[model samples]
Target: MFTPILAISASLNDSQRIHALKVGANDFINKPFIEAELAARIKNMLLTQQLYQQIAMQKEALEKMAMTDQLTGLYNRHFLMPYVEKALSSAQRYNYPLSIVMIDLDKFKLINDDLGHDAGDKLLCGIAHILENNCRSEDAAIRLGGDEFLVVLPHCSLEQAKFKTETLRQAITELPPASHKTSASFGLSSTEEGNFIFEQLFSMADSAAYQAKMNGGNDICH
Candidate 1:
């Protein structure tokens, strides 16, 4: 709440008025204050408060834009570290499992080259939608730049993560014809494997995704 304080004192002096302002008073009204003047000051204070609230809201919106991927509307890499740190801390404290899945679009370059960048973008957005739909409310889906994506699953076991990743892969495969037969490789890592470090978990998942790509895309490995 934006609270504006107006200090009114009948015996207030110059020094007292200064002190009141220094102690958080928005404005001070001395003795024999005119009703009209006081009303005008209150209106001005309310307007100032409204301006402050607008600035705060805009600041929040800008921060969200900084953290979000412009194309897919998913979280960007800039949001990854802090979110992972907080999630890992909570998982460690609660003794719950946390899993990470890395996804890489297969033949994305071919899609761009053959169908054009617009088509490729559409495919990417479609996959992003699949990731969002398959994840729980507590999970976070991030676009890690270009055609790479990551999903953070809290309180999920390794097996559960693998299953979820497979579901995402199948959904991508079955996308509408407009998506142009796009597919992705998925890799998974979990805290149940005794690794709580974010970098380590991410590396393992990334390696598994690479392996899936090596075996040909549209596969899940980990």
Candidate 2:
């Protein structure tokens, strides 16, 4: 909400009116102003403020849409780089641990082929919900396109990350029968002091995830 400013003056002059506007006045009225005119000015100022607020809200909504995945209602790849950069900077400055977990649904295409794209979408949303429920409020769960997802855990050690991923893996395995026996492979990377670059860390996690898939999906590798 915005506060409307109405500048009232005894002796109105061009210089005084300009000064009032410069000082954040929405409208200026002389001492002997008519009550109807003052009321009209107040009404206009309120309407203008309402319009400004609406514009700000709309801009915020658009920005959120740009960074969110429409399918799963999770953060999309567009939000990943900036978030990683900021989290990494904070981790380095504070000398804390940060972890990244890469998740890929096992045999996802088979599900799509067998059940249909709608079923595939349902499973993805289900998995995203599980991820959201399992993570801390400060953590980020992201959909990195297709059947791939990533979790960012700030202030988490490598061992802790592995434990969490294992729990999540089990959760996916135990999903409702409607999910058609879903499973996933998890690859984890962590830095205790934020010494590694984002690319390096992400590559390590991705390779680990690939290895997990190779070892027979539904596994975790770090």
Candidate 3:
């Protein structure tokens, strides 16, 4: 819990100090903090702070396990939900549209069965890159594991979401497929009314994505 307080800014306001406290920071001092005084404050906070760097690091590690895919750096299913909800709320509050696009790598099993798992993993990572590159700052991308990926786009309409999905569809298609052909199916849903129903919102879009897969791969269905 011990953290050295070097006043991050000379002009820091009371609100900034309060912000530091909320993050478990201790000992607020005005900037131009003498090295000695800062050291003393750190020493004082060390015992009380419970040496939190360890705790902080462990907390982050646990969060990574919870929120991220173990094999890929992409986020997990549970982590995708909140961002989607928050985006929906923001859109509703401001009378904007929020959309989500779900992408699933098609014929993934054949790659593993024929080429083996290593190549499959590389393809997954590649998809992660393509999906991430396609998103804007307000969008979030997550890997729901086992070749499933989802994106939450804030302040976006169905048209915009479809465009983003199509971009990813193209990116994935251009990537050299593994020994067997690789492809993706996309489904998109947007909040037409203000309040977005959680489960069914995704269900419709997810179903659409499956339909795309059934028809053929590398296509997006809204």
Runs of candidate 1 with Cα error greater than 4 angstroms are: 177-179
Superposed Cα deviation of residue 212, candidate 2 (Å): 0.3
lDDT values, one for every candidate: 0.91, 0.91, 0.79
Write the number of the candidate with greater lDDT, choosing between 1 and 3: 1
Model 2 TM? 0.95
Per-residue lDDT over 50-155 for candidate 2, one digit per residue giving the tens place of the 0 to 100 score: 9989998999999999999999999999999999999989988888999999999999999899988988898899899999999998899999999999999999
Looking at model 3, residue 137 earns an lDDT score of 79
- TM-score of each model, in listed order: 0.96, 0.95, 0.76
User: How accurate locally is residue 196 in candidate 1, as Cα lDDT from 0 to 100?
Assistant: 89
**Local error of candidate 3 at residue 77 (angstroms):** 1.7
lDDT tens digits by residue: candidate 3, 1-222: 344453456877888888887876656787788889877876776755565777888998998799888777778887877776777677777888888888888888988888889888989988988877777777788887788888888778888887777778877876655446678999888887544876777897899899988888777887
- Residue-wise C-alpha lDDT for candidate 1, range 56-167, written one tens digit per residue: 9999999999999999999998999999999999999899999999999988898899888888888888888888888899999999989999999999999999888878
Clashing pairs in 1: none
